[model samples]
Structure formats: structure tokens, C-alpha cells
Target: MIAAFLLLLQAVAPPGVATQVAPAAPSAAMPTASVPLPPQDWSGLPILPIRRSATIQANTSMYVHGEVMAGRCAKAVRTAQGWTLTLDLAVLATPQGRFRRVTPRAIDCPTVEQYAAGVLVGTPRDAIDLDDTQTDTWYRTSMTFTWAGS
Candidate 1:
């Protein structure tokens, strides 16, 4: 379990690290007009289906990335609760890939807590099974969102 969690943490490594999906670029076939016209309908376009695992990983990565890039997590100190706004998240699953519910736990920082909760709740997620029953898996981790130096 610890090994799995560690691997998950590595999935959200800092920028310059390689990931499976390459950054999207404008296709050569696309028009080079100064003002691009908006598509009237998206039904003709190909829809890329992403796995739940991938979605979860991407969300985690973006959460960390946004905080760091915005300088919201500078000069954080390690506390008994692990420095960051450590949250225990329970992401419920549904067919629409939307989270039926989300609950936060082990939150110590009120500001970070409110922000994280607003972001996580009602998000897309996959259902995890425990034993014979299906349930949501709780992901717990610490994260810093303080800008002390600035």
C-alpha cells in the first residue's frame, strides 16, 4: 500500500518531468487565419476517452502544479500534520465519471481546507472496491499552499 501511494506521489512530479500524454499542439491542417472561427458543433470531432486512473492522476498533478506555479506553497514548514494542507479525500464514483460525493478529512489549515474542498467535491472519479463491497477509496496526503517569502 505504501509503495502504491509513493508511486502515485511520483505521478505528480515537478515540471520538466515526462508524462505519457504529449502536450497538444495545433494541427498543421488547421487554418492559419488571424481569427479562427469557433466550431458550430463538436459532434464531428473525435472524443478521446480517458481512464479514471488517468483522470485522478492528472487532477492530482494539476493541483500540485497550480499551487507551486502560483507561489502558493513557498516556505512551508513541516508540522506534525506534514507541512501541507494534508487532506483525506473520499471520491465517490458514478457512471457519468462524476463523483457522487466527496468528503475531506484530516485537514488542519482552514484556508487550504476550504479551497481544496471546493475543488474536489463533485469532481469525476472512479469507484474503488474493498473486500466484497464497492466503495470509494480515500487518498490522504499533505500539501503546502502558503506563500511566506512573498
Candidate 2:
């Protein structure tokens, strides 16, 4: 079931985009028995889907397009054909799949980092499947965004 879910997520992701997941540091106070075992293959987790929001999409599109058109990211080799940005996010959620926070690791481009964080923040709480056995733990996930040159 997890395999299927991951495949479905990859199928829906745009070209050049990828997702990976990892367990965050466990709290020292938390009982070992209570802490769920982390998945061996962290990269196999499904990518969280962004919520349907025209405003967010439009804003992201405009920002990325503007940056590409202006050649703001052209210096990077990844921008030769276009621009590619990878964002690493630390996500905290409840067992019920409610998102508590989505924090992005800083990148060279502050604006892009901010946008990536916003995208995660805009994702639906239940987008990620959290079983009853899950606890309130942080998960590390990465998302890559690519845009073709005009």
C-alpha cells in the first residue's frame, strides 16, 4: 500500500520533481516502545500533495516565471535549460495527520525558500497518510521544483 501511494505521488509530480522522507530526532523523554520504528527506505514515502489553491499557484507561477525571465537564477548551471530548486522541509504532524508546522531549510535564494515553505504550508493536513500507530514526530522531506526557460 505504501509502495502504491508513493508511485501515485510520483506520477502526479511534475517532471524533475522528487520527494524523500526521513524520521526526525526522537525525544529523549519519549519511551522507546512508544516511538515508532522509522522506515528503512526514507525516500520511498509519498510526496505530500499541495492543496488546490489558484491564488497560491498563480503567485508561485508568477514569481518563478519572473525570476526565469529576468535571468535571476541563470548563474546556476541548473538554470541553463531552466531553473531547479530543491527544498528540504522539516514537517511536524499529529497521528490524525494534522500538520503542526512545515519549516524549510534555507537555500541560496531566500525568496525561493520562502515560496517552498509556503507551498508546504498550503498542503492539506491529511495529504500525508498517518496511521494510528504514528506519534507526533517530525519528518524530513525534500521537494524539487524545475522550470523550463522561456
Candidate 3:
């Protein structure tokens, strides 16, 4: 599923624009279990639908056009049981309308270590698609994440 997302991202913004977030230190913590994505009947080929009025926000003030967002992403982990990968991620889709203010770097997610070390972990990930409508000011997307390599 991630591969398909990556391919879509590539088609949208190219691989160079797509970024990743890795733990400062690899953890031995294994994934609890693996869950598979559900299957659904479709009329034709698998295609992610786009939203025309989508809104995405970053940081405390950054805003983007959700229509331009090609895809979302998360982390990659491995479990001993099934080599299961635990992906924790966030995404933000830019809104269509213009914003009074926007800070591109503010949307990034910070590292846990950075926070623990007393550093104000600013935007750790380049962009975080907030699930909260009031806080993030964005809407949820149809990612349909399916477990792979399990």
C-alpha cells in the first residue's frame, strides 16, 4: 500500500519532495500485532479520490492547499513475529483558499529525543496532517493503509 502511495507521490511531487522521519535511536520495541487493510469492491482500477474543498494546516499558523497534496506518509518498523512494520505518521493537506498567515517549517514534527533533551522540538516531520478539524483545520483522507511484509 505504501508503495502505491509512494508511486502516487512521485507522480505528484517527485521523490525529492517526499521526506521521511526516522527515530534518533532505533528501538527494540516490536510491534504488538499486524492488521490487514480491508478489501472493497470497486468499479475499476484502484484510484484515490481527490477532494476539491480539502483544507490542510501546518504548525500553528501554516496553511496549504489540500488539493495539491498527492499523498501522505508515516514511519516504518519491523516486528520479530511477522517482520511487521509499525508506521506512525501524520499528514496535512493544503486548503484551497488563502490564509492570513503560513509558516512552512512550522508543520514539521519533532523527534521525541529532541523533546526529552530539553530542545523545543519544532516541526519534527516536515508536515503533519492533523486529524482534528478544529485544531488541524483539515479533513481525513482515504489512505486505505494495508499491512505489508507481515
**Top-scoring candidate (lDDT):** 2
- Count residue pairs with overlapping backbones in model 1: 3
Model 3 Cα lDDT, one tens digit per residue, 1-150? 434533443355422332221222334785432222122322232221233432323321111111112222222233453222121222222232211111112113222211111111122223433232332222212211122233
Q: Per-candidate TM vs. native? A: 0.30, 0.50, 0.19
Clashes of each: 3, 0, 18
Which wins on lDDT, candidate 1 or candidate 3?
1
In candidate 1, which residue pairs get closer than 3 Å at backbone N, Cα or C atoms, i.e. clash?
84-143, 84-144, 85-143
lDDT of 2 by residue, 1-150 (tens): 334544554465433332322224558885433334434454554444443432345455556556546655442235577666566766655666655555566556545555565566545443555556455656667666666654
Per-residue lDDT value at 19 in model 2: 32
lDDT per model vs. reference:
0.36, 0.52, 0.24
Return the lDDT, model 1, position 110: 35
Which candidate, 1 or 3, has the higher TM-score? 1
Candidate 2 global lDDT: 0.52
